[model samples]
Target: MAYAEEYAPTTADPARIGYALVPLLDYFEGKTLMYVRGATCRGYVEWRTSMVRANHANARTEARRTRTVSSATARKELGVLSAAIGFWHREHGPLESVPVVTLPAKPEPKPDVLDRSEMARLLGGALGFYQLEWCDLETRQLHRTLKRDHSAINRHTARFIVIGRYTANRPGATMKLRWMPNTVGGWPDFKRELLYRKGSEVVESKKRQPSVRLGRAALAHFRRWKAIDDRAREDLARRTDGMATSFLCVVHWGGEPIKDIGKSFVTALDFAGLPRHYTPHVLRHTRVTWWVEAGLSLEEVADAAGMTTQMVEEVYWHRSPHFQKRAAEA
Candidate 1:
């Protein structure tokens, strides 16, 4: 892999190189062929983690690679450190021996889960938002020559809430939903598909080609939302010509993608009379619990949820009546 000549630093070239992390970033971000040494050789693990926590604050407002430096953060940071040091050691024998880097123990915390009734309230809230938006649009475009139906709805935030509940996808993953259609050559656009990645960049976590499938209810709602987007395309064609794609959760009554739906999510949860601690992630937990209660094995629930069986067992495993009955029968 060729390095970006302008950005890369070398030993012969003593240019301060800014944060001392500029060299290692090429390795982490897949730039290639940059020399990082000195403190890295002596205390790489600590330096790497500290650099991650301290360095990335100014550049981005959100979605930073190292915003939260937890133990898992340490694991990935140290993993990269190990890889870089190992590579350097093999290519050029500078250090006598590589110091051992210890990774943090895996965390096992109890998951907060939503019951089915709470799930319904969340979906109902989304549908209500859809209807509210549709009504607002109808009031604005009332004189326009179009047939009106009370049943017609186009909700985005609510769909996200409902889909997240059933798909067991991480909130971020579900937000990556697109509008791929079921053409003659292919299946329905939304299925358990690989999360899109660019170039040689890698997922730092074990997010191994995470896949999420919409259930029948979520699929139905998704189709309705697409229809709403299609109608929106015709009406707002001049403004949104190149803007349309398969983004499932769009801003209400428009073609814009909803990147940060935290406010809306919180609003929905609050409106549904749920706790603030019941974050979007709890949807996945709720799904896992439902799967276990429905008597699915840990492996089955893990595969469906795009997580490990160990994670499923550790955090979400609970013996429901069905599982207990089945156990007694056996």
Candidate 2:
């Protein structure tokens, strides 16, 4: 718990560490390192997988459902536990041997990439308003309403989608982008047509966020968003006597940076006529898949997508036009 709280803020995805580690503390609180073994690890996995979690799909009704956890999730949690043990050993122990942390076999990758048409629909949905029609049972009349205006409340999500589609950044990195260089988050340099995905002070994590060049479409969106933000800032300053506003490129109408877009993203999925499985992370997969299908070299795609060439080949090479061409020809 102490280690997690100390390092969570420094991680690329603090929420992930927090979520994975907190529950682990409950199960392993009274236990020692010696208590961790193959059987114990398997027992932990079984216990975790048997537990039920809330179903967000029926959140409106405050419904509860029995959603069994996956081995992947258990593995991540145990991985954190393993890391904590290692840290303990390194910092304080000259003790005997380190215990081997048993982990489940890695699951096969199920990369779900969106097609161009689907991406277009998603972007359109993010930029448009919702149209709702329903019958008024009390009045016995049909009514139409336009609510949940994206331009007003969820415009930030549109910017997020555009940047994600072009840069293939993780959702957390996309949300951390600002208009100017800062010590905390990345910024876009419109003049140079590049995106510096991490601040100088930010440490690089396992998931890389290397700087990437911006495409014309992404640059145009950045410029337009900057102009709109500038105007909004000026208006706010005039009204509020120089009140400070967020420098983040993606923000609400009031210029506040959004902390989470889960609900808004779900609304976007619905508007795009996409299934629930289509998530924000799919934008990154879609961009990589598109680059592969377009005949971009593995190295180029890896660098642009902040991934290793090995990972590209392993997970996405099958999407490339040249994947098995030589074999097929032979």
Candidate 3:
């Protein structure tokens, strides 16, 4: 820092450590990291612990009483400070000292996910639900079974579950998906496969920008979903263009994105008899673990699962002989 100051007296330090924790906490809070400190640091653990304990009284379907703040949460919070310090150093040269953070340590385990059978049960259960309003059974010239085919919930949640598993995308990123035709969005070849852009919001903060490629099944589902929406409301579907739908998500009566799906996800999980702690994040871990176990390299798994190679090696399973033997190569 002295050297940097000496060399360029006009330059100011990129970061200032001589301050209370509130401002820094505020700055980091907006980002995706676990940026807990000050009041949040004091309250977060207690609040989470109380949430779990309270659930015990109302634990009808979920065994969420044991869920509480994890060591991983604390680790990430500390890492935020470390990252801030590093960023400052890179911008304004090295600092002699920075704030020292002590993080609580605990045993780290591999992330858990549903098994194949559980996945099937969840999908089947979601598909079984019938949305009477969306399905015009009385007016349609069809039988009972045939008219029940138009389930908006099934298209959204069940298909969402399927796409989430295959792509291993963050739920937010998956929901933000848009399908752009080749001719419209500077893509000259329409036959160049069904490509999905996860959009700038998803990639702006991320280091490795992703090119999301839809699998055959995903492509077919998207196509079918768009067709269904268009068939249901031909006028609204013509808003974007004569091309693909504006979003690759299931919409409501007015084509507005459903703000929350937690309730439906819970019902699906209960139907599948899965652990209550299982969430959409588990899909990422499952995909990474499955790929690693199936002999994909750490980098390969990271690319497919939207994670870093280090994360894949650390959070998935580290004891695999395949990863162990090729540690030097990575």
lDDT of 1 at 202: 23
Q: Write the per-residue lDDT of candidate 1 for residues 18-93, one digit (tens) a residue.
A: 3234534633464222333434333434544455455346645565645644555545555545554665666655
Q: Best candidate per lDDT, number? A: 2
Candidate 3: 10-residue stretch with minimal lDDT: 181-190
Model 2 stretches astray by more than 4 angstroms: 55-64, 129-153, 247-253
Candidate 2 lDDT by residue in tens digits, 34-89: 88899989988998888765344344443335456788989989998887777667
User: Which residue segments of model 1 deviate by more than 4 Å?
Assistant: 1-99, 124-154, 181-205, 210-213, 238-253, 320-330
Error of 1 at 218 (Å): 2.1
Better of 1 and 2 by lDDT: 2
Return the TM-score for candidate 3, rounded to 2 decimals. Answer: 0.60
Listed in order, each prediction's TM-score against the native is 0.57, 0.87, 0.60
Is candidate 2 or 3 superior in TM-score?
A: 2
The candidate scoring highest on TM-score is 2
Q: Cα lDDT of all candidates, in order? A: 0.54, 0.80, 0.52
| Candidate 2 TM-score, true structure as reference | 0.87
- lDDT by residue for model 3 over 148-204, one digit each (tens)? 223424546776687667667655544444333331111111255434434332213
